[model samples]
Target chain A: MSNNLTIALDIMGGDYGPRSSLPAAVEAVNLIDHLTLILCGNERQIRCELKKLDALTHPRILIEHCSEVVNNDDLPSSALRNKKDSSMRISLDLVKSGRAQACVTAGNTGALLAMAHYVLKMLPGVKRPALISTVPTQTPKPVYLLDLGANVTCDSEVLFQFAVMGAVVAEQAQNIDSAKVSLLNMGAEEIKGHESIKEAAKLLQCSEHINYIGYSEGNDIFSGKADVIVCDGFTGNVALKTCEGIAKLIVHKLTKALNKSLFNKFLALLLFPVLKKLYKRVNPDQYNGASLVGLRGIVVKSHGNASKKAFLAAIEEAVREVERQLPEKIRYKFEEIINKNA
Target chain B: MSNNLTIALDIMGGDYGPRSSLPAAVEAVNLIDHLTLILCGNERQIRCELKKLDALTHPRILIEHCSEVVNNDDLPSSALRNKKDSSMRISLDLVKSGRAQACVTAGNTGALLAMAHYVLKMLPGVKRPALISTVPTQTPKPVYLLDLGANVTCDSEVLFQFAVMGAVVAEQAQNIDSAKVSLLNMGAEEIKGHESIKEAAKLLQCSEHINYIGYSEGNDIFSGKADVIVCDGFTGNVALKTCEGIAKLIVHKLTKALNKSLFNKFLALLLFPVLKKLYKRVNPDQYNGASLVGLRGIVVKSHGNASKKAFLAAIEEAVREVERQLPEKIRYKFEEIINKNA
Candidate 1:
């Protein structure tokens, strides 16, 4: 009801702290009109950065002082329990209390997920929340992959719900109507994977809510065969990480190959522009943020190593979620499906 | 004994006809010393291709006539039952009857696996046969990832044995004296994955036959953190496919960027050699074959679309299996582990 999109950001999260978060927040504020930010962290550090920004002051940027920090090595549950005034916890509380429309954090993923589940609660009929991310595909647009690393072990029902939720996100966020949903399987065959996936396939096949394309092999993910690829968190997590590792390896090898000799080095100099574009296309930071779906309030989890660009993108993603009213739409769809089936 | 390292190949298995298989067999024979081949397929087509080869008269090459071909579309069970005189069945029988040291197939992977399991039998103490494939790591050496697409659902005991078998293969093939084995998990923590991986991890941690390296994430697979990565076939298949898909996407994107403008095209021409070398390094054909570990007889399965190079590599892999006595070694190791634990 505030008439403006306000995002509560955990300024103390990620590797670079307020130095990255403040710049990212400022960049996001400048990019989006009618936007406000509540930067939650130690007030002194935020104020120091804010002083450096000579832009005309607007009431849009506010600071909520938080006294504690959650280090990466801290046990997620212990951190959530012990650090009551931690920046991440405070940011989530802001969304939960309706002080902010959405929450953005690059803190401990486990802690963020736990706090979100405890505070915002799952949507009706949603058993658990799924962390969904997008990877730029060879298609004309990006493909959204879900359950990236949220719940490692899930049943058929969870997978079916993930498929539905992923399709909804793709339809609203990526502007892809009738998003094709495919289950990630070992092979394209009907009888190629674990029991849960087979059961999920049966459910998805019967559902009219989605454009349930049949099974897709891993190679088909980036082939643009489907707009949304759904799987349990374990496999999805591994797939995402594997893609990242391979990208890094490719870049490292290319750099080494380029520097092997004088001719190659000169070629590298000429190819630097195109190679840089290609590298940016595959960089995880450019696509470093994911949304924790199935919760009552919007929560965006940025990568732990996220830089200014990635953090800002995460804030923009949160703004998009608020603008789209993703939670309300999700609720309406789930209700429609459940009532229709009933 | 024939005293020849002869292999019987199923010429009718893969997507292409004897066009690919026959040439591949000829190429394999040229590389392996004192090696012979029994090309099993329709009599007329085999003879026609054989006549095209200048070395057909050499004592090393022979042809086994098979009346029927196993179609990829045929059901695995039905193919095994009705295709009695099929090339795939006949080739397996050649290995079983001691007429050939091993059998190589690029046919229907399911039917090939079924035939190998039904005919050659499992190594003593191996409850299930695992399809172990080599993945080229960022390092100069390759990492052996097992249960790539074999058993979709496996118990803890089967995974524990897979780790041992994979370790042995990596040691023998990569010439690594101490093979480091790691269980692929969603995270590096102990409680990160399902119950099966957790139990498997406990068994592997105390395993005496292999160098157990605890847990590894998907990124660790390419970092050379472990020489052998063990997982259920479901996860392994997806992970491997994801890597393939991502690599292809990177290459595809690079191709696009390089062709965008004249200057980029010039750079591409200058860097063509290095780019080609990098492409060759990541090509699926370079790591094309999989070994059916835990089987009593040596069986190597190649990609259905394998070119002459991949087929030749499959033949070489079978030769290595014979030289290393992989099956016997696996049986001994499994028996030792079972006995000690019991």
Candidate 2:
């Protein structure tokens, strides 16, 4: 690990713009001793935020101005084609040009991916990049779920590629040895699911590269079962949001229930420590970083409505991925598979 | 409504055989004023269970002996082909022969659907039967989620049919008149999702029969934003199981957290009442019955491992559907569409 670990922050993206990103970047910089930050956005806004922390002239902190910001509603293709001077594009340029080891953005995810793909391009032998995120489980660590929302529509080949890419992340980034890979399906049975998934399953089963486990139903995602679960982006996104919705619904119900009685209020007070711990473990903020896997360089997308803490978590993931040389490992893995096929 | 609304119970089905079904049947009989039950299964086992409940001589309760039982391992085609003497088949026969208005089973869902379809056949214009279940939401009533695990794969036309069927059920059964219908997709935007979903979205949008709201991600399932959600069985099944998994994980984590310390234990005691309500509300058993929709006859599948209370819920759903003439409503809706096309 080098002492010159630099991660770029897209300070002008996300709902809160610089408000959340600036504080979160500072938090990450403070948390990681060897880290330096390249804040790419409007110079005046970045300077004002830095002055709030009284680190305007810090040696490690560098602010690069971009003329425009990529708003959440901006079309990905339009942003890629038109918003060349936007903070999102400029920050990604830092990653593409090797000026920063990694880039983190709490911005429009589609725009970030679109720009990153156009700028950084995919690694050799990789068909497409998948959105990779760590979903919570009963295990000491989280399971890696990929193709969360990047490619809404996918075929068997794309799904197969996701398995290969996800396997690498599960093994290298998550550090799961002999990582068990499973195709996310409607049922665990071999006969279940659609044609593309069935074909993808056959491909995975025959491949010796991955420890291809059998099909995993949605429930299996949080069961602490498979190390990596792959699905077409559509199903994966629905499943991810489904988990969030249920958690939100449960928490909402619990809140309403807890507010009903004095005894319930007392119980909540007594249970605050454990409840807080449980909530923290399941919090979306705790698992906010979603890596743009299959990209040539490290780029992590923070939740659009992320708070400062959540954005900081995304920065942490980017730093970790950069330190591990995630792209290098994925490229090596992809080339290895290609050579084997040849 | 006459006092002759009879329902058939597949007593030999499910894990508990006659244990859960007999009690559930009795509970349904007691709960509904104009209800009778034909307990169809092995004569000796039915008698033993009936004796246990002291229901042997009840005039409204009739026993119809079945020679064979359909095991979960039995293939759907084999169960339909050879298991004619099975309790599941015999129960469907009761519905077909006009001895019962509905059939209830806590058995292999595939076997039940097969036998029910073989004996009853599909309603005109309905291509395939979809499994429908009401998942709890923030709304006063739960939202109807369909294709829980019926059709493994679905085409655009089939998906459109699901929307129609779901809309009818939402209107007549769930009583959401002019139900807001939505296609389950990864993204809400029109350009997002796969070919079939995009096609289905067009069909839904163009059709005036359903109050077709656009695409709904998994979160919207519980947000009470739409009354009915329709998707292919694979995605729907994964989404449904994903909800179950998250709920289980949260409960498991909460249980572990609650037992961590003396303070937590004390809090658990004070929060017992509210926690109990929350648990009851979220329990899978509370949502036991899932209707086998798009079929000509009303059939309800209970969770195979359902408790007496859970099985009772399934029976209650069947009773409600039979009383409301759900099949007739769906048939009329289907025919109306067919006539409009013609």
Per-residue C-alpha lDDT of model 1 across residues B53-107, encoded as one tens digit per residue: 6656757778889998888777778788888899999999999999998999888
lDDT of 2 by residue, B226-282 (tens): 989999888888888887777777777887777778866766676667776776565
DockQ of 1: 0.74
TM-score of predicted structure 1: 0.96
Considering summed lDDT, which 10 consecutive residues are worst modelled in model 2 chain A?
A: A278-287
State model 2's lDDT. 0.83
Q: Indicate the DockQ of the complex predicted as candidate 2.
A: 0.74
Report clash pairs, candidate 1. Answer: B13-B107
User: Interface Cα RMSD for all candidates?
Assistant: 1.3, 1.6
Considering every candidate listed, which one attains the maximal lDDT?
Answer: 1
Clashing pairs in 2: none
Residue B71 lDDT (model 2): 92
